[model samples]
Target chain A: MSILKIDGVSKRYANHTALDNVSFSIPAGCIFGLLGPNGAGKTSLIRIITQITGADEGEIYFRGERLKPDHIKEMGYLPEERGLYKKMKVGEQLLYLAQLKGLSKAEATARIKTWIDRFEIREWLGKNIEDLSKGMQQKVQFIATVLHEPSLIILDEPFSGFDPINANLIKDEILRLRDNGATIIFSTHRMESVEELCDHISLINRSKKVLDGPVREIKDAYKTDTFQIIGNGHLMITSPDFEVLEQHENHGVFRANVRILNQAKPNDLLRYLIDRVEVHSFVELVPSINDIFIRKVKETHHA
Target chain B: MRKIWLIIQREYLTRVRKKSFIIMTLLTPLLLAAFMILPGLLMTMSGDEETVMVLDESGLFEGKLEDKKDLKFVPIAGSLEQAKTLYQETDYTALLYIPKISIEDPKGITVYGKKNTSLQTQMRLENALEKEIENQRFMASGLDRETLDKIEANVKLNTINLSSEGEKDNNAMITSAAGVVAAIIIYFFIFLYGVQIMRGVIEEKTNRIVEVIISSVKPFQLMMGKIIGIAAVGLTQFLLWIVLSFVAVTAVSAAFGIDAAPTPMEQLEAGRVAAEGKSVDVINEEKGEATQAEADEFANTIQDVTQSFANLPLLLILGCFLFYFLGGYLLYGSLFGAIGAAVDNETDTQQFMMPITIPLVISFIMSYSVVLKNPDGPVAFWMSIIPFTSPIVMMVRVPFGVPAWELLLSMALLVLGFIFTTWLAARIYRVGILMYGKKINYKELSKWLFYRV
Candidate 1:
């Protein structure tokens, strides 16, 4: 079942339409990717879902009910441009944010304590956020995002500033939260992370959703039946069954990317490559989300 | 409501816990008391005694100039030239060189000093010479000194206002002074707390913490929480200042043996007894002992002041003061908050600030010049009723006794104005806080105000 169903939400600013007939649904207990480039109405839509703003022309359903202020208690949002009160102590800031999300003081404190210990940041409890490093502050930001154990947590570029290790740490926590029956809407244009983490995504471009599906399904749909073949022999044969998209020759060997057209399959392409060049390794080249994003955005831009 | 309370708690505690707030709260009253007491003490304290060497070149008079408490005179036995030549050798403050001139045409009467003598010394010398000449003239005309003295008359005009309270004694000078002072205080507090709200908004926006906050609470709640929180801070400071200032003034005035207000409570009782014997004041003004009459007049002034204070509708005035103070701040505070939200930083707020500041300054000036001049005038009537100017202008009229209907109308409009401005500001604020790096002007701000956020 979908935890959030956004139906034809449209938002207009003073001069421009921010979201135009945008519709998407976030499946329950899944990491949903809200993928869009800068000024692509992602923030605008997120703001609507968070109830920071209202849609000009649409209805939003949270858990099959119309979205209302009370639903904000189940929702937690960490904006891309997020920060904490610099002069406020880390522990107090966490408790304040948790309470703001409708947790009682005692509940928030206990949850904050667990998170602080889990993150091994007990020493930072009484210290002001300004005294912490950027990574530490981001961790605190993440902790604040889920302190109330919100059902639908929205993280915008949650790993933007973290090092690889910290990013993995947060990525693991995100997966763990999903494992524990919490839905997370991860908004980012960083397609590699979307590939690494997002199960489902809706691509918004120019205030319109140009793409939507599960990551694997979208990748499969955008598949060009391309295959990368690396071989020791360099003589390539051109045939109607297969086309060598590109080939680069090295010392006594050639690496080629080929696409099969017509009714040909990857097995056929592998057999064809085995006849033309001594095929050492044959692998199907699945479209990366990056290439799909760029191509999709470019197609819309040109249109 | 709970969310707003949390926001308010955060805003208030963060500010109240600041070192600057603590220091300012503790120090402002003492500093104000010091400013009040310092100049008076400086002026009243006597300076070193200085004896002047007199060179009567005109020979019209000698030893006629009387000595004051801090000034003395010595008749030097020498020509004016000799005295001037011997000036450096004498331990005198100045040389009063009265050159030979006609008594009828007295000019070039100079007092020369190493450093020029004080104005008091010069005035004393002029009085002495004028008296000596006047006495001479009186002697020549065969007029008695007593009759001349009796010929000088003094008049005091007393104003009595017929109000609903019946025959309330109104001192125009004192009442207007009090009114203007209260107006100034209202103006001061509104700006002080209004800027605090603005800065607080700017801080949250610049820190990029506003979005995080508003996600959990409505923008209106956040705005009001901040505005109300800072108001509480201002009220806390203001109340502390009043109490501390009263204590400081009383202690310092007592230490210096000066009567700050002369126990209005005690004198209120004394005033009733003194009222039965009003003839003595008139008799003294006519021909009683100069010192006795002066003392009596001084005592009457103190009693008159306390009496005026007693007659004033202080409870009503103070209640209105609080209403106007909070109303004015809220009305302007929302605008200040909007301005803060519209800009990326404080430096970019000049254009937006003009609207709020201009009205505030205009009302303050009007209260001082227009409202104080004629509290019941048409200009005062309109200004007192208008929400933008009412807080200050009405305060100026309050002491001069505003009509109850006008007071109610002004207060009602102010509350409505506060509501309207807050609504307008919230619209602008909800959009502006999320906007960054945009070079915003009034056109941009108006656009923000209409955004359906």
Candidate 2:
């Protein structure tokens, strides 16, 4: 079931078009990646989804109902520009934010304590945000974003300020939230994380969605019939049916990477390569999400 | 609505807990008390007496000039040159040389000293010489001194305002002073607390927390919450100042063995009565006795002046003060908040702040000058009626007794003005808060006002 469906939503500033007929949906319990480069209308679309801005045209649905003010209580947003009241104590500020998200004070306190304990930041609760390190502040902000246990959480560039260890900690938490039936929409230019964590994604470029699908489906759609083979022998004959992309000697054996041409299947390429070389290993290469993202964005840029 | 309430609570609690807020709140009343009482205390502490040497070559001023506790005049029989030489040698503050001139032309008298004599001293000496010359002329004309003294009696006119209700004693001096004080307090609160709203808005915007907060609350709600929260802070500070100042004044007055400290109006009236007492003393000296009836009349006049404040609509003044204080703050606070949203930093706010500040400043200046001088004048009436200046100018007129219809009209217009500014400001704020890195101008702000929510 789709938790959020943005239908032809558009937003325009005075001198620029921020979002142009952008449309996408996030399924329940799925980690949806909002992928875009800088100035690609990703933040604008996220802002529209968060209701920080009103869409100029079209509608957004939350759980098959039109988005309303009360819907904000169920949605959590952590913007790319991380901010907290500098002079406010960590615990007090988190409680205030949680209450603002429609949690009762007791509920907010209990949840905040649980999150603080889990994040191992129990000692820093009484300290002001200004006294915390950037990574620590990020942890506090993340906790604030999810403190109310919002059903649909949106985190924009959540891992930008985190070190590797803390980033993995947050990643684990995100997956845990997903497993517990919380839908997540995270927007970032980091495609590596998308491949690792996101089940679904919509790549937006220049106010339009250029590519969107499940991670496995998108990788499959962008796959070329290419095969990498490592063997002891090399083929001397070159056929127009297959092109040798590269060949090198590794571990006293020949390894060749080849691309199948014109309607040829991976199996056919493997059989052709096996006939020429002692086929010790055969594997088809799939394009990384990073490569797909760059190529798709560049393709849309040129188009 | 609950989210807005939460925002207001957060805003109010954080600010009220701040060290700066606590310090300022506690410090202002002490400073105000010091300002009110220190000058009078210093005057009483400085008890140095001044001696004046009077050289009457014509001897016409013999025994004419009297000596007071602080000022002593000693008669010196010497030539003009001798008096000048003696003045330098003696400890006299000033030497009065009465040149042997005729009573008709008493213009050549010179007051010589190391430094220039104070204006009060100069006026006192001139008044004494003029009285003596008039007496000498009157006696020479064969008119009895008693009849002349009676003819020169000073008439005190007690002004009373007559209306359909009845005649009420009116003291213009007291009313004007009270009106200006009220106007000034309103002006200070509006400016001070209005800027606080602006700074608070700017802090949220600059820190980039506005988006996170506004995602749960509308921009209008956020602005209203902040403006009202800070206004509450202003009210808390004002109430504390009033109570603390009252306590401090009472304590200081009690410690000094003085009566409860008088209002500014009572103080002014007391000074007038003291001046009149000096003339009364002069009259008693000449007669070699003081009349009981005359003393009773003088005491009654002081009582009347002090009681004049009782006739003033103090409760009404206080109610209107609070209304206008909040009204004026809301009107300007919204504009200040809009400016805060439109600008990236404080420096860029200067241009936008001008249109809002000019009217406030104009109202403050006019409250002191035009409104105080002629509370019933057309300028005062119009300024009091105009919503922009009414908060201040109307408070200046309130103590002077404005008509009910005009007061009601000003109150209605101020409410309308507040609503209008809030609507306009919210429009700009909704768009401006989300906008960044743009050098916004009046044109851009106007465009923002027309943007669809």
**Winning candidate number (TM-score):** 1
TM-score quality measure for candidate 2: 0.82
lDDT of 1 by residue, B1-453 (tens): 998999889888888999999999889888987887776666456445778888887777776666765667887777767888788897788898887887677788888888867887677677778877787677668876677877867677678998677898888887887778888988998888888888888888988888888889999999999999988888888888988887887788789864334334435644654566654453334322234546466657756877788778899888998999899999999999998898999999888888889988998888877778788999999988999989999988998888789999999999999999999999999999999999997787777766677
In candidate 2, residue B361 scores what lDDT?
96
- Candidate 1 lDDT over residue span A61-168, tens digit each: 999999999999898899989788999999889998888888999989999989989899999999999999999999999999898889999988787899999988
Q: Provide the fnat value for model 2, as a fraction from 0 to 1.
A: 0.76
Q: Give the winner by lDDT.
A: 1
Give the proportion of true interface contacts each model preserves, from 0 to 1: 0.80, 0.76
Taking the tens digit of each residue's C-alpha lDDT, what string does model 2 give over B1-453? Answer: 787788778778888989999999878877877776776566445425778899888777889777766668989886879888988898788999888888877778988879878776687678778878888898889886689756766666778888776998888877877778888888888888888888888888888888899888888989999998888888888888888877877666657643334645445555466545544443334222235446545545566666677777789998998899889889889999999999888889999989988999998998877878888999999999988899999998998788999999999999999999999999999988878899998988898888886
Residue B42 lDDT in model 1?
69
- Position A232, candidate 2: lDDT: 83
lDDT accuracy of residue B426 in candidate 2:
97
